[model samples]
Target: MNSVFIRKALLLSAVLFSSVVLSQTQDEVKKENPTVDFALEGRIGVAVGDKAVGINVGGPSLKLKLNGFKIGVGAFPSLLVLDGDAAPRLSVSPIIEYKKWMLITPYYGYDAEKKMIWTFGIGYKFK
Candidate 1:
């Protein structure tokens, strides 16, 4: 009876090991699949020292393969609030992204007064 129990334990161990190895092999193959593509990223970054709140919205932006690139527009409005009146200060930035992550854009933005400003930044893929 003891010998039978030992044999059963060994068989179970062998089966578990085989399953793990097979899974690893399959994962490697999937990684090398050329047809497989992924593009989806979302990040929250801050710009300090400007004393202004920055909001960036960029994601699944797509690479040059699709539409040559994607667009990323950001806005920063003044944070002043007073007696049913708010000072409006809006800034717009249009960015071009590559591979749905690498954001390489030179924007012609404007403030509430329509003043022009330049903005540039880089991004990373997270998917």
Candidate 2:
């Protein structure tokens, strides 16, 4: 069990570090072509479902803005704190953002127990 946790922690760290590097590269590309609109932002929010309510953290979203619409996908690591037993999970969801408000639907989450769950969430994004 300890080994599993350590592995997960390491994997998460690598993902986050890679995302930051990717975001920086995108910024440089955007500077060269002003027509391309790309953004990376942090998100934090709460999710609730019939079985559980959880807090979402480390939600790094890569977004594209066209006209007035923003669309993206985010990977959220969450803690299901209100469930029968607290569990850590990762959720990947399609995201739509207007201003700072974010809507996440069909949030597909995979937990340590290898259970898959679908839920919906609302969140705020930080610029």
Number of the top-ranking candidate, with lDDT as the measure? 2
Off by over 4 Å in 2: 1-41, 106-115
lDDT of 2: 0.62
CA lDDT, every prediction? 0.39, 0.62
Model 2 TM-score on a 0 to 1 scale: 0.55
Which candidate should be chosen as best, given TM-score against the real structure?
2
Count of backbone clashes for each model? 1, 0
Off by over 4 Å in 1: 1-40, 43-55, 59-63, 66-101, 106-109
Residues 1-127, model 1: lDDT tens digits: 1445445544553454345434543232336657868765464322211112333344333223456455555443322222233344343444444442433232334445554333334434355
Residue 7, candidate 1: Cα error in Å is 74
